[model samples]
Target: MISTRIWNALPGPALVRLLILLIVVAAVVLVLFEYVFPWISEYLALQETTVEET
Candidate 1:
């Protein structure tokens, strides 16, 4: 049974290109979130806080 009509409307080559583009974009986002982004945030937070004086 067919569920979607839009896939049938698209040419087969276009569908494959769309899937590949989605995968590459998802990978780029994950790399930034896991490695580069957290370090920048931590450095900024540390700069904002004040040390206690004895």
Candidate 2:
């Protein structure tokens, strides 16, 4: 696949390539949790309501 090809093209030895891949994955996860999650939470936030006694 394209990703495999891209991965093969990366510089450095196997261990270094693995480290770079891990770092990239970690960065993506961090970005999603820190920025994307908060942005999504704003739109999906739950609404609070009070019940009136009759």
Candidate 3:
């Protein structure tokens, strides 16, 4: 329902649609890098496992 509503609301032009899609993708990537990645790094133990044995 929400997706359909969004689809229906979008402009009916190929170029405009592409622009909107690109803007949305850019915003999502920005949010992920700025907020989500930093928040997730605090919980992951990725630094605890390494190949160094000295």
Candidate 4:
């Protein structure tokens, strides 16, 4: 059964569908790497610890 009618609105062949899905995944990953990760890192600062000099 079709869970939602909105999804069916994107009519396309199998290859086209696969390409669109790939593009969407790539876009999300790009956003994470380019903006989201860097912004989050500023707050986390997961490397704050430092060794003392003798």
Maximum-TM-score candidate: 2
Q: On residues 1-54, what C-alpha lDDT tens digit does candidate 2 reach at each position?
A: 998996898789999989998999999999999999889878874555567999
C-alpha RMSD by candidate, in order = 8.2, 4.3, 3.1, 4.4
Give the runs in model 3 whose Cα sits over 4 Å from its true position: 1-9, 52-54
Model 3, C-alpha of 36: deviation from truth (Å) = 0.4
lDDT of each: 0.73, 0.88, 0.85, 0.79
lDDT of 3 by residue, 1-54 (tens): 996776667897867877887899899999999999989989998778878778
**Candidate 1, position 4, lDDT:** 51
Instruction: Judging by lDDT against the true structure, name the best candidate.
Output: 2
* Candidate 2 local lDDT, residue 31: 100
lDDT of 4: 0.79
lDDT of 4 by residue, 1-54 (tens): 472453465569767866776787899999999999999999996879888999
Q: Between 1 and 4, whose TM-score is larger?
A: 4
Off by over 4 Å in 2: 46-54
Worst 10 residues of 1 by lDDT: 1-10
Q: After best superposition, candidate 2 residue 51: deviation in angstroms?
A: 14
List TM-scores for all candidates, in order: 0.53, 0.74, 0.71, 0.69
Which lDDT value does model 3 have at 47? 71
Q: Give the alpha carbon lDDT tens digit for every residue of 1-54 in model 1.
A: 352554455456876857866777899999899988987888677657788999
